[model samples]
Target: MRGIRSLNHLPKRCYAAARRSEALTVPLAGIKPSSATPLPPQNVQVSKLPNGLVVASLENYSPTASVGVFVRAGSRHETVENQGVSHVLRLAANLTSKGASAFKLCRGMEALGGSLSVTSSRETMVYTADCLRDNLGTLLEHLVNVTAAQEFRPWEVSDLTPRVKIDKALAQQCPQIGVIEKLHEAAYKNALSNSLYCPDYMVDHVSSDMLQSFVKDNFTTGRMALVGLGVDHSVLRQVAEGLLSERSGAGAPVAKALYRGGELRVQNNEALVHALIASEGGVTGSAEANAFTVLQRVLGAGPHVKRGSNITSKLSQGIAKATAQPFDATAFNASYSDSGLFGVYTISQADSAGEVIKAAIAQVSGVAEGTVSEADITRAKNQVKADYLMSLESSETLLEEIGAQVLATAAYQLPDSVLQAIDAVTQDDVVKAAKKFVDGKKTMASSGHLTNTPFVDEV
Candidate 1:
């Protein structure tokens, strides 16, 4: 996490300009510029290959190089029969480099002191690597090979498939996981929320052939995006072209959108009380969506951990020794291509969890009711904006943001534009967004000692 904090030493001119204007009536706390305000990304070059792949490049003066492959395939693309296939696909992707006999992609990556990994979100799968700039030649060759020359061995798949399945099964045993499953099932009903990741049954059902078929249909050059940073464009392009030149996709079509609605509750035998609530929030493009984004940051972001705050700290401390735990809450605003979800989760003493949920509900309800003051809006805005700026410290983060933003939406804008949009969000906007969320259809799911919790019955 050695992130943008290092940028504190950058020339004082940049820092000085970021200082708040003295003449403004707005408190310095409200209007102080964050790192995101001053730095605009240098120009990004975008081009398309004849085969339909997109290549986007940005140069960072940072010494490390980062590369990523983003594909438009995730669990949303899974069918009931193939529910966990995407997860399997992500796992299988790693084994390709491990199996590469001819070029030994993994060995080459390691030689460059680099690491490669693949991760998935609700809509896309991302394969990424970071290395020293000098090793770009060998690293690119190996990177392309892993995606292009994937050779799934019978033994490897058999071993890996079971291991992942077992791990997922074990994870589900946790009360937190059960609560999440219940929440999604409640909020999204049978739709994409329920399908964020494949269930264990689907994982067990996935065969090696199904995985290969998924790869064939989804890992298309036509649907792929290549993102690179801190490396020469020509060298990266040459490497990408050489490996991908002859490769042609079977051209799988994009998946359909699914939005089933309902509520789910999992009653578990445990001492901890857990409750969750999720509701409809707008997506990235809507004005309401922007308002919701700022509101979430204002309400949830903290000087503590990513999900830490005085509320969580106080709740945990109060219930630390009680039969019911003090309340621990996590509020999330998840965005997707077509829709989004806003959620609040809590864990508290079996008896007090209900009160905790009430407090949280009351808190958000006030936001909905337009009770948040200018000071609340200002602090939340500043903290949210500051967090965004602090996150841009590394080339990898910037690289990931660019590639994911493109895959999520084909259009890309500077971080400054996003910051400006956030800055422009007014108190009225956040309250309006909150009202929409509370009044709209939402879902709730939970597990572990929640049978008697009030949120379970809230509606």
Candidate 2:
């Protein structure tokens, strides 16, 4: 009552002032302001070491950095006697370098809160590390030393067999991967057909000495590249030069990838048949290669949209209408240095496999006969551009792109430039790329229930 009387006694000006000042206001000094304009994307800089090593780096203000070494040595370069050497190297070399205990190396990396991994593909082997900005030098030194000072021990190789066996087993279990491997085997007679995964027989036979020879022969400066993302180019170049040893001479020439497509069928207990039907696509970095990529997008692997069917692809949509059993078609255009495979991989119940395969082949044939619409080409270009841009968002992916570009082609492609190239593609270009793929002999491989999977002649 006393407070109410005091308020009533206040002057009109004072009451108005109190009411106006009563609204709550927050202090904003603790908040960070967002800029109206975004900073421009950083550029990738390339430099070659005096010893023929190529180093590429992109500088950014990211808290984490990626350091990777990419070499043009993978299964495709393996000899018949040393089939799984690259896969073995992926497990062994990084662990047991000379005078370095696998335990200590692993513990040290863990202490630094870093991660290391090795990946081998058909045409490239990459060892990459992700660490903090402050640990750049340590990561670089560790990478170079582990690769350079490696003595592939017999015990180390033997000890790592269980992990290697697990990888092989997992690949076998995934029908998709198994079918693709068989497809490559059927497509290429010798070189490009090299298996990416180790068979059980090859795993035990691959010796430490063989892996060492592979490292010595193929880890040459000319065929190797050091790539860093979110790091200084000059620093990466200096560290790479200071640590990277000189090479004697070039290694044996990698075999040329020839596409002599044929047929392969593996019988399995899987309920559905998995099939891969492919033909020659273009080499990497070619305009036609880009077109095939766009063509692939137009035809589309699985739909970009999640967990649903997209009837946009003529082949896939046609495949659905042709068969009642559950069937799926995913377009793939895998490109290597000299050659590539462009086709669709499908899965379906045995009863529907033949019809789906026929529909898939007709789709490829249809593309050659100018079946792609202009709007389809535009949408595919947009998807391709979007995917490429999304890749740029990751340091690891950007590192792969830059390093692969440098080591494979000695060229760099800005994201804008790649997007522009995709934009320039016409319906006719996509058709031409498709026709080029079909010009070569066709390769077909099937797994699971092989009863309805057609032979090459039927396809």
Candidate 3:
């Protein structure tokens, strides 16, 4: 299973050549051959059990499998009092399994040679198991036990309390994660986006009784999506039917929520100043959202520290006053249910922090004004399209892509169609996306040595 982290081992000379070309020329326009791209995925099968849980499957010949139990209960669903319940739910899933004690649950999975993990985002909470196909049953049985009937014991909650608090503190110290949290806070400060990771205060508030109530409210059959990759969905469905069909609770609220934007700065002890500049972008369905993705690739893709292209140079210059040591910058196009975050982040020396932000803003402004040449668009499109296609080579990524599409939209869409749509975007579309920030309101969060300098004022 080749990964983006692995493909990064290509020769330095290749990156050097790419870096040398600064003239925003569209080399792909006339040279690269254009033909219809065959959709790589065979197809996806989606069905619902009598209990209302979605069962999705995609087959791969690989000897490995990835099984996930996805629930539409996460940070976005929390009120101020229940802020970190989503995180607690994810953690609790790992500690106990169906009618089994925590110790037994851990030992069973370890004996089966399986890896169990869980993560939460704004929209969903996922519990995953990755292992050889031979151990699929053992894994699924344990997963069903944990998700559907685990007991949130008092001792278990007490033991995990300190660990969760430590994690919260660690998140605050890391510049990259801190900046992202801040940017999201700026965009949806009072709603789901603002409090994706429950604060320590919220974690302390999560008693054993609270865990049971939280799980009862959120982890319901009606609000769940069961995803199995590289394994038979029908087999999983038959085996797990009794467990997931148990009635638990209703679906989450689907009404529109409000979000506001402004500067949100949090000072922390780190050498570099980390800045996350964020602006609202369209959600997944809009044409503007697709265009913004292309824009993100052009400016944020590839290894800037090692590849060092013109776009990277602009970022480096922006953060020049901070530190002489090299740092990284990335533009993230994170999609939420109602809106998106077109964010750019930089880790640079604290001294040049203000200059770095100004330079980044200028670069964004230039792209919005259509200063980017056709070549930039062509190369960016190809890079994004090719990378996205290549990701499907692995069963894990393939499954994630399928599930993500289904989660974002009700129907399954081919990745090639998505690529084609991205390729169709012109410089004008890119400019429009860039204008969402350059000429519109923006939000930001910064940590590290940022007290002496401030971000450029928006007019």
Question: TM-score for each prediction?
Answer: 0.81, 0.90, 0.83
lDDT of 2 by residue, 361-438 (tens): 778778889977888888888888888999978777888889889997666878778878878888888999888766
Quote the lDDT for 188 in model 2.
90
Runs in model 2 deviating more than 4 A are 1-41, 324-326
Tens digits of per-residue lDDT, candidate 1, 1-459, equal 666666757898786678666654345665766546554556766666777777787876557888898887777666666777777777776575443653356567778999888888667888888888887776776777677667676666766766676657776767676666555555553335545555756655677777767777777777777888876667656655667654566466654344454666666677877777767777756777778877776556332656544453222333343335435665667776777777676776665666676666666776788877888777777776777787777666777778877655554678798788878999989988888767777667666676567643464
Sorting all predicted structures by TM-score, with the top scorer first, yields 2, 3, 1
lDDT of 3: 0.72
Instruction: Decide which is better by lDDT, 2 or 3.
Output: 2
Estimate, for each residue in 185-273, the C-alpha lDDT of model 3 and write its tens digit.
76675564646566856766777877777677778877877788877868767754766777444655544546577787777666788
**Candidate of highest TM-score:** 2
Error of 1 at 129 (Å): 1.5
Better of 1 and 2 by TM-score: 2
Query: Which pairs of residues collide in model 2?
Result: 301-331
Order the candidates by lDDT, highest first: 2, 3, 1
Regions of model 1 farther than 4 Å from truth:
1-42, 97-99, 173-178, 189-191, 194-198, 239-242, 245-251, 302-309, 312-326, 455-459
- Cα displacement (Å) at residue 285, model 2: 0.6
